[model samples]
Target: MIIKTVKSLSQALLLVALTLVLHSCSNPDEGSAIETVVYPSDVIPFMDQWKILLGDGTHTDEVEDYEAPNFFYVANDGEADWVVYKTPNAGVTSRTSSNTRTELGQIEHWTPETGGKLTGTLKVKHVSTSGDARAAASYSVVVGQIHSNEGNENEPLKIFYKKFPGHSKGSVFWNYEINTEGENAKRWDYSTAVWGHDMSVVGSSPKTYPEEPEDGIELGEEFSYEINVYNGIMYLTFMSAEHDTVKFTKNLLQSEFTSKAAIPKQILTLYVSLGRDGIERKNAYAGEIQYFKQGAYNQTNGKDPEDNMVWSTGSAIYDGDIAKQYANGSYTEVWFKEATVGPGTAPN
Candidate 1:
């Protein structure tokens, strides 16, 4: 009888010890210190601090609105197909370069010209035909401009922006068809994309985009193009463009689309043209983008329009306390204009 009583007491002690351990592990302050996992929602507040959302917290100011947003559903074979959303339709408007019919769907075009800024609402919805499908999660996205032209007049198609941060420069490259993994990707997540002229004519080689972050998708179910910039030189695979593997790289940047972001001091440049394909190009540093407001007098070449419309704009970089404006409209070509990479370095 005494041994039985002792065993019960010992079990009670072990139970108490287990409870204490669990309590310690669960404590957010002391003990094991519960680690708070940061999901997309958790980091949104920080994104707001950077002021990347369009329309602040409201839904009225849409960067570009579609009566129905584009939808791609996972087919029975586990492949995601580009399906149209009946409720919120999707199609390329007349403003866009591409002409996608209703059956093919459309995309609303919004660029710096639309507002010179991208802060707005994009409502996305999904409905499942099967009961076991993933629950439809709606989203509202804000796309902001990151970089404009390459600061060279010869190449006008180059445009960059923070589509959703935590991606790579190529994420914003020209004509790359971004196949997001899930629905409501723009607002629910972040990515970055950048593109430039591929000076090397050697050409036609298999290419890879910059490595994507764990929280993002790089080339998920999409035919991406090859127009990546490393160091100072840019590469473009014509084969990719010819086959429409991705959108034409030059057109991608020229469209002047703003993507949502989560960084301060985002630099956006819009390139006009990269000069001719085989002509002698000028140096890139010659390009100088000055302070020219939209609908204001542009003083780049002392050329003033009757309406005082600003052609393009560039950001000034600090060189040893000298804030020199890296003119996006300064050059005609042959040189490379280095963008001031902010604290956020390209993901290694």
Candidate 2:
């Protein structure tokens, strides 16, 4: 009888343990369901081809299975996954730029003749809301670029998206910085509009905001761009499902703004006060080493706009506190669902 009782006791204990395990499995608060976390590399597989610089000045080349909190990371918005690039209006930036960025720089360098291409499907999530409305660079962020890695490290192309506070729609534009013939200090970017007004559109006073673009893109609207430099010529295509598609062709081997007279009217209004009327060299970014960059290059800063109204943005930084700036709308965020880096293909 004692032996039989001990066996029964052991079986009862086993049954009790099984019941507890089943109950825990059904309880979400006490469940052991492992959630699979996603990384930027999982969403976009081109992390190996590029190195990244985060908003707080973190740089890394090995981005495989890597994710940085509140800066470079992956996000899911119910329907799709996105690689998010976020930065405050002010942060520890690289030596070359006063502005901050959480952007990817292409590892492979190429000349215009050698040719390369980059494509990104993204949407601008947020832009700094506190800035002088009259300042041209205020409330703006650069999303893509063809950056010159050599010769003063000037940028050949910078695609921008800007919106004033209280505006429902924003402008999309691209700027070409003159490969200044003599002085890099005199370099200026020539702006061209794709959907709405170019970078030159601004209010008359510091606090006044301009009218919203009628044919503009909203903050979360999707857009895509293709930058193809083939045989010393750069071909650009901007596309969106709700907006008209636009294409532009520019010659990298030749200068379009070689003379002062070639300067566009937008520049006259935007940079004439700063005396940035320098012209490009005859061979514009032809032999210069170049690379592609994509992400949120924050244009807003805490500088006084009265110093350089065209380029400076008087945004609130909360004494360089990134958390405060992010909470107060003094930040920029961009999300990319897709991106590609490869050799330039022949134009169709």
Candidate 3:
């Protein structure tokens, strides 16, 4: 009978193509999953490791008053004015207005009072003339001493463990995630910013998240990061394999970076140093940690909601183009010769 009706229609088309390949491998709607970009470790162990006990340390006016909690101070507000005094340490912590500061930038964790690593001084000029017309000014002071930890922004590492007796409870909260693939796998949440002090090396983070998976389709690439240190407190997470692979050559510390607008263009600077032995040496965890990705804040749903309360960095200067200088402080540079955006984009 016609070869049994063509062998019963070729066994019903191989049982409907194996039931649609097991229903599309069990239905996967979302974006599919794949995204990664996180940085803060280009090596930078030290080269001269920032040692400017005074002037020859560079920049002057009696060496622009740097007491040495490590070191870094860059400033300039033109037009002319005054009223600067950044003194902390001796105990009085308070700076959780959430986030906002940049005019020059840098006043991070100002705490120092004879505590083995003590130093604090900032008195830049310009108070009136609307802080010098506002168009633009300059500032750059690179200092170092690394080690970071400071919680609260949703419990960075909630302290008070009986006033911090080596407080530890399995520490966790560096959560990093990114995603985006075919269907709709969207899931890119990462924004907590605020935790500085925990040094003894180990701030470089990266175990996985730099890849080339192969067969299963991951020939795309891969990368993942995680750094956790209890007691001394250190928690970092990067996790990026796709969503904009993430890459930044130099950015002299301004909270490592969150971005909105504050990086105009200057040679770029950094003198960041952290590693004062245990517990970051004498309490109050060293000083000088600056990085300002880009300034001019204002944004809610998209991100940076506004509050750039005009920070400060010693008499800044770097006419170099997309600025590039590291180690001295760690971030804040701009000097663009070309390539404004799109080599992979994402430095704004």
Candidate 4:
């Protein structure tokens, strides 16, 4: 009897040992299998400095550790992760404009005399392919800008990228919207070419395309821009590996078009339909408070090209359906690797 009892005790001990071993093996360290993904704020730390509006009309001021899945997110391009800003050709837009956009508006405001500086390194991934070629704004996207916070909410500066479908290259240009001296209805924009024809150049017909610029930048190509408004002087610098670097200087405190005679032919043709023939103020954007903006401000829309060819883009919209618009290639996507914003520096 004693021998039988001792044997039973030994078997019970063996069973307990096996159970402990199995439990430890089944539950390994919790940290071993988890991998963290980097976000847009990780690449560009300035996201917290401004507020963002998504293509779906999502507005948020907290962007430091925030990201929207389809509109604003981080994407890996085989080489590195980039912050992407994408928007449909037609979607919910801001109250002041009819165009759609996924862009950032700076929180801080400044005047022409006080000045500010903004820099960005980015690439245009895609743009709307279908639009009236004769329209001044068709098939174009605004990447960066300076907008007035008061008065007519007019823009002081807008940088544009335009490319026709099936074309190998696109034009890069910047526009200066006049701060009307009196009536705000007289406001107009003047454009300057960086690597192609200015905004004034357009096709004779809706289907026709002008000769491609020889020194234009192509889609997916990398480029950088610096907009420095220092001591009432606006200085611009554009750089790309495929073309020569370009630099321009304009006075923000003074008007280049004080009379109708100073208006360019492009503005005459582009604004003729819109009735924006107003002359600029003697002091262009001098005392007015302005803010900066960046991202994909889609210039295309679903409006009929026949009504207003220049501003109206006839792009396809699946009745405000985001997934359908993306599938149909009716959206704009831009990626930015680096950017900075701060007080303007003193001129050398």
Per-residue lDDT tens digits for candidate 4, residues 162-214, read 98877889999999998886678767788999998888788888778998888
Ranking by lDDT: 2, 4, 1, 3
213-306 per-residue lDDT for model 2 (tens digits) = 9999999999999999999999999999998899999999999888989988888888888988788899999899999999999999999998
Clashing pairs in 2: none
Q: By lDDT, who's the top model here?
A: 2
Off by over 4 Å in 2: 1-31
Candidate 4 clashing pairs, residues 3+ apart or interchain? 135-310, 186-278
lDDT of 4: 0.88
Looking at model 1, residue 212 earns an lDDT score of 37
lDDT over C-alpha atoms for residue 30 of model 3: 39
Please give the CA lDDT of all the candidate structures.
0.21, 0.93, 0.20, 0.88
**Candidate 3 lDDT, tens digit per residue, 1-348?**
999999999999999999887776787653477654211111111111122221112222221223222122222235322112111111111243211112112223221111111111112111111111111111111111122223111111111000011112111112111111122122121222112111111111111111111211111122232222222233333333333222212111112222223211120111111110111111212232211111111010111112111122121112211122122212222111111100111113
Better of 1 and 2 by TM-score: 2
- Sort the predicted structures by TM-score, highest score first: 2, 4, 1, 3
Residue 28 displacement (Å), model 1? 14
Error at 7, model 3, angstroms:
3.2
lDDT of 3 at 50: 28
